[model samples]
Target: MKKTVFACDACGYETHKWMGKCPRCSGWDTIKEYKIEKEETQVHEKPLIVNDEDFIEEKIVLGMAEMDRVLGGGLVSGSSILLGGDPGIGKTTLCFEIASKMVELGHNVLYISGEESLKQLSLRKKRLNLQKPFSMLTTNRLEDILHAIRETPYNLVVIDSIQSTYNTSLPMLPGSIGQIKDVSSNLIMEMKRADMAHIFIGHVTKEGVIAGPKILEHMVDTVLYFEGDKMLPYRLLRAIKNRFGPVDEVGIFQMSKQGLISVENPSQFFVSERSNIGSGSTLFPYITGSRPIILEVQAITPKTNFSIPKRISLGYDSNRLFIIIAILEKVLGKPFFDRDVYVNVTGGMKVNETAIDLAVAASILSSYKDINIGKNTCLFGEIGLTGEVRKVVNMELRLKECGRLGINRIFCPQGVEGVDSGVAGMEIIPLKNVKELNSLAFSK
Candidate 1:
């Protein structure tokens, strides 16, 4: 006899009790139970073999500079890629763009989707002015898809989404942990054997991760994600993992009437709609995941009756906000209990790192004390519990961008030098603590 328990389709963790909160990873309602079938028959494992003649290192190259740079030069043949994002964030448009480029390269590509019909895809492509020779399949059955792949022999294959694809023999329903894994694993293995590249558009959950089990990410060779708010029309393509190329490379695109146009100077995208007189608004050079961009930070403190202050923030981690508030109260001798401290990063994008700590603190202080920070200047430094403005990483890269955008001054931690290569011929004002920077930065 064999025993089995439910596992989280997103992150593979086994559990007995069905509860909303996961004990292992603290994810809510992601746990799914499925029966594991066992067979008495024995099977043999295959041995590995390696040879230079058997491997061909040719990757498909699309001329789109932004897309190509993020994929580590180009899409590798016979590699499976996973793109995870929320609904209506241009995931489908990107796939069509890739298919169009592939067809231009004289490669036959097949786009099998379960979400839309041929007519709907045609309409969207026409809106995008896309004219490419490619085939589309509308089916959920894994067997039928396998047959199509076998007979069609397309050079490239794209699965609009893996969550919608299901396995027939499995007793679990589609989108279940078991079925999604089976489908992804089977497709990846088949692609390897057939020497075809497979692309899967995965759905992101409320927790901001892929919907399928954590294992789904493991099944694919590369994982890419769309970053930024859809309302802003600017989206960033970031590579979290890549077996063929380097990770942390980002590609910027602006969704518009002509589809996604590459934003060459991404710094301009962050600096939109400047206000002259705001009680508590300032700029911050936020760098996270190798992305260097300057963003506006605004803070407002309103009188409140509640004993516990209402601490609210947008596009920033709540826990990080809490910690900083506590630090402000204890270390800096500030009172926040009598007011509601609200913060917003302007653009609806998540930025979590210690790098923006100084900027955030400055914005809040500016509001609390009724001061003004220079509009043409941005600050990037980490704030410690002892009121020290700690130095951040990639100072050179940060200053270079700041200087390029007509930003006159940058206030960072003290003791930072060019080291080797850095932004020169600019005022890189260095300070040790909040009090030191405040004495001069706000005095003007």
Candidate 2:
């Protein structure tokens, strides 16, 4: 029997009748009707428990160290990965590079593009100097794409975009919620059955989230977000959800005339343009994935003529900034009411970890009082509402990275485990609370 049901586009909340607003998500007019035809079910196959040693999973190494690292060493066969990013942010370029690299390793790879023409793909290939040839299909029809994949014996398949592809049976236009859900479900089932590895490139909304129902992220084995400023050359590929690897792992790459090149030393690259005597700049070690990266947190507090001092931030959370500012005012007796505070994480990187709390507070104080904290000094700790400095995870890793970068002085929470046997030539200063920052960093 065929039946029609209305589903919310935002959260996939479905109901039998249509409503002006989604009851689940409270999104107005986000409900759309879609027909479903129930089909006959087949007999279920018997399940058997198998030993771990009996089943060996195979992985395809793409030969790119950064890409492999983000994929938890390599791509597992029969797994589907969803990658979302802004337009022209190198999502396609990065996929093309991955396809080219796989072809060089003599793997049967197929590149399906619903958005670009065959000529356009060729031009990009020439520009990237990709000499190795791979299978290419330029079509938006879901039937044709599925037929091509099933007919060929491909080890890997790349879908340029899921939004552009549509099924003819669906009356809705391409990129609709129904179409995305149906297309991705079918493609994933097919890939799993054939034991093929696939990568789906998805479009992101204006708010920088994947431009489909949140269900799409849950459907894939791994979800990666390609983030970077369009004006800048650096791009960060971060794993948001991964069943096979650790989440929040980031792979750094530098865009060049040829293609995306992996950054070997991201810590050095991020702080390469830093000035030594800058009052507003403070060095902080951040851990993204398994690697520790040294980042420069810059803050400037200039007196504002307006009644409300602007609290502006770039690459750092604005709400968190407000909280930090309130804590500094209540705890440190710093008068930021008359100044416009600006905080930025250099290198176009976004930091969400609470470990950056102390560094941000220090940078703000440094700029306000016009004190130089020195480029060789680094700090990382979480600041509580009561002015206490909380300890952070991976303290040893963060400290080692600072030591390797030639940073001699460190400010961290008191009683860090590795402080007793500290890094050679590094002075580890333990801070008990935000109140100590004034005398330690500023020496008033």
Candidate 3:
């Protein structure tokens, strides 16, 4: 008798013995054992070589500038894109928008939905007011969908959730790790063989990671995540993995009654209602993808009666906030151990960039001291543990975004002295350490 090997589905860590938790990825109960059978060797044939002229480098432009930016300048032929997001987070709307655009450009598109029926899809199409000639197929059988794509002359195929589609021949469930891996591999091979573009909509787990086997992301050419707070109208499309384009690129969209609309000027949209020069408010220019947008960072420090003060952070990393507070106390000899501090990024956008450190520190100190930072001033720089300020990438872009928002004084790292401020009459103030931020703080 032969023993079975267990593999971690999350990270594909394999072992001869099964454990309660995977040591590699620290994922509990993610290891599953499977049987492997020996197969006989078959004859191999020499494959024909193709010429260089057979490969086309030109990409299909998605028409939407924001989406194209995230996709590295449009959709590539024979590429597989996996888009994952929370339910009702505008994934379907964005897919439909893309299909409509492709159809309008005379490209045939086939949209297959395994979750929604034909009538339900028609209602959504009507609501979106899309009159494009793209074909739609509502089916859960993987064989039927594959047959339809083979018979149709479609340039692009959209599978609205590969989890819902199943292989009837396989005994495994539709969304099981083994089933998902098999299905995705088959679809990717089919699309690649046919030299057609395909996009798979994927569901995400509660932890905000894409569901199914981790290899599902690896099997695709691009992995995009549609992220945003449902309470807010703004949505962001980010490509975490892209073989053909920049992975750091992000697309901004605003949900409306009609559908998802591109947010061309995100700076204005984010800072339209920015607070005036007041305590606890600081303007920070954040770079998303290649574009810079000015955002407001707000913090409030109130005396707490509880023995253990609460540290609440919204749209920012709570752990980072605590670290920043500790740095402030160490540098400035100010103790906030007895105070409750709350930090928030105003636009419902999660900012994890180290450049926003200065802004966050300033906002917290301004609130503690009951002083206001200047409304015309904007700042961005990474703060080290020694209280020294560090230079950030694309300083010129951040300054330009601030200039567009009429921000005059900008505090940045020392190396940014030579950046030409795109906004006239703008003053570039350089800071060497976090202690210098005290000079900009308003008096109580």
Candidate 4:
């Protein structure tokens, strides 16, 4: 017997003999090694020598500022983006918004929705009060949709969901890995041949992950996530992967009966109704997705119901909340060990920026110490275990934004050197420890 060995497909472990178990990647029943048969080369194809001006390339502008920014200023011809989000989070609304804008700019858009019928799509637009007209196609067959795109001179195509659309050529159902791979690959090839911009909508799992094979995301030019609180009508279009724009870029939209409207300056939208000089609540600017937004953080220390008092953090991490509590207890003389600590960042935006660390610490202690961090003052910085507040990125820019938005006082991390006073004439209160902030919050 003449045979050669190979590695497992799921696991990278090499196998002299194929086994049931994979040693490296630990994937079950995935170890299948095979030998390659030798073949002779027949064709010698010359590579196409490239020049910048060789081909006349025309791109489509999607007509949404945030959407265009995510796609590197405009949609590259024949590029595809995967749009994934939870159900009822205004993903379709944003898609319709994009289509409407494109139609207004004289671009033909094909919105193929396997999830909704033409009448249903129209009903959504009616509810949104939008009168803009565009082509709407309802089909589940991938081959039929490809034929329609080929027959027409459409500038863009949007598949409402890749999981719901099936290819008749494939044996499996629509959402199967095989079908997704085959359909996506075929769609990409067709889009390239036709020179069309495509956006593939993907349904996500309950755990906030995109359904289907992970390779589907890698196969696309960009991946857009519509992430926000489902309870609230507001939604955020987040770019987790961008071939052109910064990955952390975001677009805030509020979903109403009328449709998704951009929330300009979401900083004000988040922290507007904050009560001044309140216990258990403090307002500070939290950098969310590279945008500095002021938010109210409330922390409550109540009697524990369990032996290990629960630390509940809404819109942030529980471990981070506890670490802030520990730092506050040790360095700021605020005690919350035996009590159940509950922390919340209002507006339902998760902020992991190192800049918000100082503000979070201050808010927790402000609630515990019965002090206020002042009404018109916003704070942000990183905190070390040694109680030394560390400086954050774009201090001057944050301060400028705050000042432009009428923030009176700014608390920055100490050693913000070269930020001369009155450069913006904003009061820059630098603090080294929680104690300094504690003194200022309680000081007359």
Global lDDT scores for all candidate models = 0.80, 0.89, 0.87, 0.77
The C-alpha RMSD of each candidate to the native structure, in angstroms, is: 5.4, 3.6, 4.6, 5.4
Greater-TM-score candidate between 1 and 4: 4
Model 1 lDDT vs. the true structure?
0.80
Candidate topping TM-score: 2
The sequence of per-residue lDDT tens digits that candidate 4 reaches over residues 1-444 is: 335664455423566887777676677776655564444656566888899998775556766666675566777767788999988787788888888887888888889999998889999888877677888899889988988998997878999889888777444546766577778888987897787888899999988889988999898988999988878878888888877567877777787888887787787887767745576776666654456667777777777878898888887677767677888778866667577878888877777676777777776666666676677778888888877788887776677667767777887887766664434556788898777877876555
Question: Residue by residue across 283-336, what tens digits does model 3's lDDT show?
Answer: 999987788988899999999888999899987888888889999999888898
lDDT per residue (tens digit) for residues 1-444 in model 2: 787877776666778898999787798988888887777776677999989998687877888888899999888878899999999999989999999988898888999999999999999999999999999999988998899998997888999899988888665568877789989999999888898889999999999899978999999999999989889899999999998888877999999989999997999999988855579889999998889999999999999988989999987899989999999999878878899999999988889889999999999999999999998999999999898999898898899899888899999998775554346667889999988987888976
Model 2 regions lying over 4 Å from their true place: 1-51, 417-423
Off by over 4 Å in 1: 1-48, 51-56, 275-277, 288-291, 330-332, 417-425
Candidate 4, lDDT over the whole model:
0.77
**Count of steric clashes across candidates, in order:** 3, 0, 0, 0
Models 1 onward score TM values of 0.84, 0.90, 0.89, 0.85
**lDDT of candidate 2?**
0.89
- The 10-residue segment with the lowest total lDDT in model 2: 416-425
> To one decimal, what is the Cα RMSD in angstroms of model 1 from the true structure?
5.4
For candidate 1, write residues 119-197 as lDDT tens digits: 9988888998988768988888888789899887777898988989988756556787778888988888887889888
Sorted by lDDT, highest first, which candidate order results?
A: 2, 3, 1, 4
